[model samples]
Target: MDILLFLIIIFIASILQTSTGFGFSILATPFLLLLFEPMEAIQINLLLSLVISAVLIKKLLKDVDTGILKRFVMGSVIGLPIGMMTFLFIDLNLLKLGISVIILVLTLLLVMRFRMKQYKKRDFVVGGLSGSLTTSIGMPGPPILLYFSGTDTKKEILRSTTLAYYLFIYSISLVVQLIFAGTSKTVWVSSGIALPLVLIGLYVGQKLFVRINQTTFRIFTYIILLFTGLYLLLESL
Candidate 1:
């Protein structure tokens, strides 16, 4: 029964990630938390995210906006350690509620169509904030990146850029977890099972995104985020 739920959630989350380049962690982590401890869930999710992002990197390398990726990644690098430190101090319930709030606010922005739609100046801000929040909250923040990119090019540029960002962040997290948490074996085993699901999910999401128009996609996006926010909010209690 648990495995079934894991597979189902991974499929949906991965598809969401494949098409939009964000939300896999946000959507999947909360579901995973229902079964696993928050720390374990995040570690495995990060590992799976790293693997999936690696698989997609080659295809999206040329498409990636290096300028945007670099600044975002650099900003993330600076903030990640701070977030990790802070995360260590916070209780699981608080973590869940905080992430729920972030998802709620972002969902509202998406529903109201308040994205900046510009990549240069706004991307730097978005990238920095996403980096910090992703590290702290485990959301990975592609929706924030999507809004900052402010163009339909999110399927391409933002997707590729976010893939790169996760690869980096998760790599760091893996090492940190091994050193700090000592749950590497458990996290690795679960991630091995989840990895294939992630790939399959992306394939499905890619197909969905390709077939749908932007407005239609955004509607789906908002609905999913609202649900994710509510899910986290409920789980936090």
Candidate 2:
């Protein structure tokens, strides 16, 4: 039963991640916590998410916004250490509860068509938030996704650039996590087991991406954000 659940979770999360470029950690980490220790679950999420990003990045290079990607990387350097500190010292349940509320509120605002103008400074801010979230919860997608949605970014650019940024964030977070929080063999072994599922998801997701129109893509994003927020809220409580 446990193996079945693990497979199901990895398969579905990989599809979401591959299709959206931002769902693996958001969808997987919380559930992985049910099956492993928090650190193990988080490390597994970071490792697999890094794999997905690495695999898809080369193909999406044309769509990347180099300026924005640079700023995100710069800001994340600062936020990564802060996140590691939080992971080391804070109570995770409280952090989850807070983040859940924030995600829920922001998602609602986004659904209401709240939009923001994108600026260079805001890019750095979003990156910082994403980086902090990455190490603390093994989820970095929320801030970036919400920010891009607010700015009404094109799907191709959003998908490509975020995946590019994730390639950096996930790698750094995994290293930070291992150094500060430590790791177990189960984290690596489980990630290795899920590799094939991730590959399958990569193929299917690329196919689905080409078929999804902008309106439908936005709807899918909203649904994912809302679901993530609700799930975390319930789990934290």
Candidate 3:
């Protein structure tokens, strides 16, 4: 039964990651915690998310906003170590509760059609938040997703740029996790087992991406954010 759940989670999260460029970590890490130790779940999420980003990034290069991507990378460099420290010393449950509240509030604002203008500095801030989240909880999508959604970014640009940024964040976060938190064979082995599913998702998700209209895409994003926030809130409590 655990095996089945693992496969189901990997398959669904992979598809979501592939289609949306931001769902795998948000959807997978929390569920994986139910099956593995916290560090193990986080490591596995980082590894799998890295794979998805690496695979999709090349094709989406044209859509990437290089200027924003550069700023994100710069900001993430600062955030990565901070996140590692949090993972080492902070109480994860408390961290989850805080993150859940933030996600919920931002998601609600987006739902109300709140808009924000994109600025250079805000790009760095979003990147820093995403980077910190990555190492701390193996979930980096929330801040970036919410920010982009608030700015009313085009789906193609949002998906492509975030995936590009993820390629950097996930790689650094994985190394940070291994060094600071340690890992077990279970993390690597499970990640290997899920690789095939991720590939399958990559294929199917690309197909679905072309079919989803902008309105449907925003609706889907809202649902995912709300679900993630609520789930974390409940789990933390």
The lDDT per prediction is 0.70, 0.90, 0.91
lDDT of 1 by residue, 179-232 (tens): 655574666677778777888887787687668776665666677678777987
Model 2, residue pairs in steric clash: none
Candidate 3 residue lDDT tens string, 151-228: 999999999999999999988899888888889999989999989999999999999999988999999999999999
Candidate 2 wrong stretches, greater than 4 Å: none
Each prediction's TM-score against the native? 0.85, 0.97, 0.98
lDDT value for candidate 3?
0.91
The residue ranges of model 1 lying beyond 4 angstroms of the native Cα positions read: 117-122, 142-146, 149-153
How close is each model in CA RMSD to the real structure?
2.7, 1.0, 0.9
lDDT of 2: 0.90
State the lDDT of candidate 2 residue by residue for 1-237, as single tens digits.
Answer: 297899889999888888877878888887898998888999989998999999999999999999999999998898899888888898877988998899999999999989999999999999998899899888999999999999999999999999999999999899889888889889888889989998998898888889989999999899989988998889889
Model 3 scores worst on lDDT over the 10 consecutive residues at 1-10
For model 1, what is the error of residue 80's alpha carbon versus the real structure, in angstroms, after optimal superposition? 0.6
